[model samples]
Target chain A: MSETKVFGMTPTWRRDVHTHYCPGCTHGVAHRLVCEAIDELGIRDEAIGIAPVGCAVLIHQYMDLDFIEAAHGRAPAVAYGIKAVRPDKIVFTYQGDGDLASIGMGEIVHAVNRAWPLTVVFINNAIYGMTGGQMAPTTLLGQKATTCLSGRTAEANGYPVRMCELLATLEGPAYIERVALSKPQHILKAKAAIKKAFENQVNNKGFSFIEVLSTCPTNWGLRPVEACQWLEENMIPYYPLGVFKDFE
Target chain B: MAKGRVEVREEFCKSCGLCVAACPKKVLRISDSINPRGYRPAEQFQDGCIACGICARTCPDVVLTVYRIDE
Candidate 1:
């Protein structure tokens, strides 16, 4: 019998430690993509990840790399400071909708406008998973969240923010793409987008942003499988999925 | 013939069943038993896996690894 090699195990950049994210949460998928990018780019030592104050706050536990914890909505600013001093290093931020589109809006906008050589992994699960499924700035209209008990209404909660479109408007960003984790096909595209974001930083490109539409099953009151379907049927239409901007 | 096998990191799997739904060969299933995390992990119930890797890609936890061996 001949031995066949089919697949490789986890990426070296990912730690062997167990993750604390709930079952079916896409945060783990996003984390794995980032680690795969780092390993593929041969930047494991030069990569510095800035963790946000959301569900991914404990990202340092899963990724074996240099990571810094930033206060709520301050990851972009913190990443900017790190990249400014160590221009040779690959710096990136993992932020959620609440942390990025809400209080950190100004910081992200200014940083992207400044064209810093850094990457941003934006996880837009619509609702804030860490804070008990509260409505976030990216929550779709008519979506149900703890803060919006009766589903989000345009008249009441205003419209959900389209971050990729918003950032693409600025002249500083070199790349911007939005991908989803609802299915295998979508996941492959998501990995490509994430890899490109990291590659942009490696090439000294300025302000690469990859927004990932993820699932939060526990808070959505749906089974893990149902949440993926919900994200496809409801969230994808509102957020859409594509590259908003790519200078390369 | 070359056969594909899957190794589930039992301790890390949350047993959300996404992989079970994703396997094209239908070789995986959620185990009746629970892991240390108190979640049921997906187990390989058959030996016809093609190592398509769809399951690993679809797994949110990155707990499953697929390998091919000749028999």
Candidate 2:
């Protein structure tokens, strides 16, 4: 027989369909990673995904697993309720920068503080890609967005929030890390982290947060190629790479 | 062995002019004409690029890449 193939053509956790996200958007990569994790964990039959508002609100549409649409910034809380009642079910949330870092910050912090047994997939693209390229909490300084056409300014807008690094400081998150879907190596690493996060939940470890430094070319008024570069040069420096905290 | 070369899917290019600014090697140039999408997408790159993957790394669209030169 031929050598064992590491990657499969289509993940069992996905519906073998496409999403409405713009071309080259990292939402697809993030969705693929979640589908991969669900497939790897063999939880496809008993998995539930909470999708928040933003570009990926329709994430449930593409995923094959049981899905529910949560109010903006309320996914974590909703995931918590579902996980608490159906402790046997594997629960996760898919949220974007605006949903998590902005209006949903309180819910996210509270959930993590409670050490909820759920996995969180946070996609941060710097700008609000869905709402027509507005500035977001993760938007880099001097980055030109629709709201901040002249670029983000410290004096005016303040600096972007480093989500993973800051969350790692909290004593609740069992596993906290930031990964990118920009390339093969990074995607491999991200896949591993995503799997680990799900494993942590399955084993009842605690709060697991994986912030993906994703890209949004259409909103950024850039080609998919250039947006990835901007994320590396500008976003990575502020966010950095590696696991901030792991209690395993 | 040399590293791989860079690949750019110019069709998805919105051409906000970031790649032209990000490429330190000056490998990427902008085209005067617009793409079918109606955006001023990026122009073609000539040889002599180091294939550092910086352009690909910095791009948010996941469209550009630096291929292995030896391959």
Q: Pick the candidate with the highest lDDT.
A: 1
DockQ of predictions, in order shown: 0.69, 0.08
Q: Pick by TM-score: which candidate is best?
A: 1
Misplaced by over 4 Å in model 2 are A1-6, A13-16, B1-71
Docking class of 2: incorrect
Per-residue alpha-carbon lDDT of candidate 2 for residues A115-184, written as tens digits (9 for 90 to 100) = 8778998998898877888999999999999888899999999989888877887889999999986655
Question: What range of 10 consecutive residues in model 1 chain A has the weakest lDDT sum?
Answer: A6-15
State in Å the error of residue A16, model 2: 4.7
Q: Write the per-residue lDDT of candidate 1 for residues B1-71, one digit (tens) a residue.
A: 45788888898899888898778789999999889889989999988988788898888777887887766
DockQ score of the complex predicted as candidate 2: 0.08
Number of clashing residue pairs in every model?
0, 21
